[model samples]
Target chain A: MKMLGQKNNRDNREGLKGWLNPLRYGWERVSYWLQRLTGIFLLVYFVGHVFETSSLVGGRNAWDTMLEMTQTTWGHTFLIMVIGASTFHSANGIRLIFTHVGIGLGKPGRPDYPYYPSSLNTRQRSGIWIALILTAVAMLYGANVLLGGD
Target chain B: MRELDNMTVKSDKKAGCDPRDDSFDLKKTTLRVFRTNTAQGKDSHFDSLVVPVQRWTTVLDSLLYAKSYLDSSIGIRYSCRMASCGSCGMKINGIPRLACYTKISELEDPVVVCEPLPNFPVIRDLVTDFTQFFNHHKSINPYIQNLNYDKTEKIDEVSSSHSHRQSREEVDKYLQFSYCIKCGLCYSACPTVATDTKFPGPQALAQLYRYYADSRDAGKNRLNIVDDRHGLWRCHFAGSCSKVCPKGVDPALGIQLLRSYMLGISKDKRNV
Candidate 1:
């Protein structure tokens, strides 16, 4: 396939060589990788977090010990990563859902036909925004709980 | 037309007879019936028709018997009475099955429920407007895309691979999908088609893959058609279409193959 492309004359554009067109193909490639990586990472973390939470069934001390671990730097970092991944993943999912459902991108401030507030693309952007805001709040709350700042 | 008139007359005469007569042995049984006319709202209901069970009776027979005898307005659809012509597909007792193919004796009832095939706009009772279903089939350009070719040389002489003819597995894969009578049983059962009308239904997609996989179609131009948004990518591998196909055509599998083909994983033989 590479050989065929090289043999073909279509590959030889003189001017636009280095710069990538992010709109058409770049975002697609980035989103594809991000969605896959985030899904795998979040799935692993979800299982581990669920198992750690299950330790509370033993006693209050076990629960407190679990909480203490979450207060540490690694735990905090993991949570942040999870929030970022979840946001990206869910936003992309919303985008896909919209596209599949036949609700194309709609005008700004104009409600979608049959009264959906936003189009699929807009809904995806909103999902990402919501995830980011919630993540920021959660991080702040976690910090307050850990450092006794609140 | 003459055969149809004869059938109607025979059915009418039979319906006029009393099954409760001393000459006829009757056993009380339940018939779970779906109640929704096409013009009505989606708030459909089911009614059980308890009647005498008989051997060699089909689900459609039970329905016609009930409608002809017990009630006149019990809406349903049927034509030819045989499984051919692709009419009379509905959910018989939770599975998408042809009413003609189902036997009452095999059912676990006294109670049998019937509903219109899912995922298409219901026309009336058991009848659905198959216009959309067929329109999508046509949209895929189901015929082999023809282009400038040797008119003098018959197209029948196109070189076909020995593997294409000799391999039973390859033949069988296409054959499974071939059994679809276009009854819309799989269409009704498919969640993707139900949720998104634009996504070409499973049967069409399966057939699309069929032509693509054929060794005779060496031209790779067919691959360009389904690479867009509403094409192969819309399939989320729900696998419901396979589950509900009365013909056992695994359309989900075909769509997956299509996805692989679009991604260039499945080698373009012309490139070789």
Candidate 2:
């Protein structure tokens, strides 16, 4: 018994754009969005790295030419971004793995008023902050190696 | 302090002295309500209405005010005028929330925007269809099953004798999830449900976990119900479902816990 005018796929669905915006819901949402964007960024970088490595068959001159292109300020900045993305991705990914296993999150209790979700407790939120801090440190180190004092 | 409706009132104190002095500052505000008429061949658009307000005025109150004197045809569903019925759910100020639960002053914006909850079809102005949403909930087998039902001597005895009993500890396992009002706020807030139509949104998945974790439930095949491609596995833990849940049901946690059950991480099956 399907009702007419009740069909889905209407213009109402937010479609792909919904993935882009994290809103003010929680840090977990920002983690989700960042994880996705970083995954894509890593994937693109992975393919480019493979191509750069395969250029080794072209001998010393060709390899040096590739290195010369990548050894620029813009290239180093992009590498730093990759470092930050990967660091955040892996750190948050571990937290997600722990969460997915039903660990760390507190037990399901009675949902009293002004209810704070048991899953998003202090421990889990601290995990997010830890991941962010770890990413900042990794990105700084990467900047030092690529574009900074080094 | 003199009362001036649900708005801010000056208590003869200077403005800067009180950091909470947003009172009485906003007397009238504009409401950008979304409107869509399929019958009239009109596209979706926001209908702006400047309505007066008080401090305790909710988004629903503003809409009602506009409906009474401004326009008689604005389609908005509400019952109980409280957060109980879960009918007045809409995106207020770009966030999915219960209209009755959200106060206009809390928005902190001159123009409050009201749109139908996303991830569902718009039936009319600020009214989204819940057909598919309900169907997903139904597909997960939201109720408990009694293995004693088949061997029962009489159907009448099922209610009294066949009824399942539990201790306080057992009750707490699934009690938190039962508070869901099915407001569709979590469904709209979910990014997975935004694009994936097959994924059974958080409400349904959480309800599934509720039944699956119940000590009285004899349905051994509960985990396998959503063990398919479009099942609970699609949930990547975005957690907006729990964040936007008005009742604090934490559907995302329920989904994750259900996954643990499915993966055999918890060997203590209550029915076993």
| DockQ comparisons of all candidates to the true complex | 0.02, 0.45
Instruction: Tell me how far the alpha carbon of residue B201 in candidate 2 is from the true structure, in angstroms, after superposition.
Output: 0.8
* lDDT, candidate 2, A1-150, per-residue tens: 121333456457887888877856778888889889999999999999999989999999999999999999998999999999999999999999988878787788788889788888889889889989999999999998887753
lDDT of 2 by residue, B1-272 (tens): 33563235244334422335644354899999999976677888888899988777899999999999999899999987889889999999888999999998788999999999999888889988888888888777789886767673676777677766788888888888888888999999988888888777899999988888788888877777688777878888888888888898999888888887777776675521
* Cα lDDT tens digits for candidate 1, B1-272: 99997787677557643444344555567777767764555566777777666655788888888888886677777886777756888877765678887788787566777877656566666666666677667656666444434456654554431223435544543444455578877666554564555666678887777666554455456655666677677675444555555554556556666665566554652221
TM for every model, in the order presented, reads 0.55, 0.90
Which residues of candidate 1, in runs, are more than 4 Å off?
A1-150, B1-26, B38-44, B80-82, B148-173, B218-220, B269-272
Per-model clash counts, in order, read 6, 7
The B-chain TM-score of model 1 reads: 0.75
Which whole-number lDDT from 0 to 100 does residue A59 have in model 1? 100
Runs in model 2 with CA error above 4 Å? Answer: A1-10, B1-26, B151-156, B159-161
| Model 1 interface DockQ | 0.02
